[model samples]
Target: MKKLSFTTPTAQKIYNDYFNRVSRCTRTLPEDDQREIMMEVNSHIYEATLAATPQTEVDILVDALESFGAPEVVLQALVADKKVKQATRTFNPRHVIQALYLNISNGVGFVLFGVIYLLIVAFGTLIVFKLIYPQHTGLFIREGHSFAFGFISELPGGLTELLGNWFIPVVAVLMVVFYFLNTLLFRLLKRK
Candidate 1:
């Protein structure tokens, strides 16, 4: 029920535009849910811009909105979250499909994260093969326009040979970092 007042006209206008987008995105949601999300975002914008000098107010507000990500992205995340909760509470096919669609679409970084994780695992396996073979260069080949991995006799060369010994440690570090990132992403999704 309270209002947010910005001293600068430009800052206020920016907030209005961003809030309008947020409102449009939340239209399909329940009134209470819509109100809750708006309140949280509104408070965040105020907190973010309150510390900024007048000259920096618009920039700070824009950055704050950007940090929340695109309006559609936030809506997808919220929809996915709601659908998950709804699915658990009921057996509606519509809810399940909605959740599935949102999740497969723009909801979370699930597919992208999963693909990256799988690639990391594959590369990690290749590194292990290199370590075990030691004598052989292994097989990761570039065939004119493409790449393949195996004992294909006369191929370009293995990733192990191309990358040398450093590949293993690098992949190991990447695996750890990606795992951490995936965890952080889930936490953010859960908060939504």
Candidate 2:
């Protein structure tokens, strides 16, 4: 990438420091991704500086950087986007978790996705609990109506264990359903 030239030392220092911050912000990405982001940001700043006919290098550069905003704030979307692409490509849980953390606040879709994931985890837990305490873990009925569906230490007088040995399979099917919902939501709500 071509370096921007500034007559004033302060302006030069500012430019260098800004790029340093950009490098830090993009450090977690792949090398090629890092270079692409750096180049794009450099291009924007350079264009902004060139378009303005300011009195001095410092003035022009300062205006450009100010319009560009701070690296951490401005580059978050770009970083989050690349992280999502990487996570999708790799199918790595760690990357997905990091991507979720980065973009969780951007929209309500991620929050819904998180809820579905939690439901899947809960179903998995139910399967384990059913194995550990078969008699106590299952759908419970009370007074001829469905009441609760989970493990309980003491069964109420009118409560009855409904699923029995079918609890594990039911929970497994629920896990699959939640997993599918999560997948569908991600596919629909993910940024292009």
Candidate 3:
């Protein structure tokens, strides 16, 4: 940050105080960007005070700072803009938590999405478990017995083998498609 000069000690002190508060508020921003903003604000202050030639320098400085608004208000605007810029950037823990909270709080869509996903995963897992444990392959309930592919009684083995071969790939494709769709939906919902 460049050192700013003022004709009076009171003006210099006031400018420094206001900028210090602004700097503190912008600490969450990138270092270079923060420096740039501080410099820009400082330049604006100097120009405004210098242009107001009829008033005392201290009075001009005070009026300029006041007109620019409080540091806290300026900081809030900057921070909000920064957050919007970062929204599409890489994810961080803070962003993840914020997303989860927003979705869960906004409506039942998030819960429904989660439940549907869980059910799909559970069905896929159950099939995998039956395939792995051949002896315990009771995935379906018949009139008085539990059996795998019981509906295809004449081709039980063939049906089970066919499902076992294709279930994993189908589930995998569904997962990828759902992931993309969910992400798209989330982004759309957030914009709303």
Each candidate structure's TM-score, on Cα atoms with residue i matched to residue i, is 0.45, 0.71, 0.51
Model 2, runs deviating above 4 Å: 1-20, 27-31, 43-63
Q: Please provide, for model 3 over 1-192, each residue's C-alpha lDDT reduced to its tens digit, 9 standing for 90 to 100.
A: 676788789988988899889888777666776887898888887788767868887888889999888878765756545543454354343643334443464567656555545554565665665567644433343444544541232333323243445555655666667655655655564476
Candidate 2 overall Cα lDDT vs. reference?
0.85
Which candidate comes out best when scored by lDDT? 2
Every candidate's lDDT = 0.63, 0.85, 0.62
Worst 10 residues of 3 by lDDT: 150-159
lDDT accuracy of residue 63 in candidate 3 = 93
Tens digit of per-residue lDDT, candidate 2, span 40-102: 999999899889985688888989999999999989999988987786677566777777888
Q: Pick the winner on TM-score between candidates 2 and 3.
A: 2
Point out the higher-scoring one by TM-score: 1 or 3: 3
Let me know the TM-score candidate 2 reaches against the reference structure: 0.71
- The pairs that clash in candidate 2 are none
**lDDT of candidate model 1 versus the reference:** 0.63
Worst 10 residues of 2 by lDDT: 183-192
Error of 1 at 34 (Å): 1.5
Return the number of clashes found in candidate 2. 0
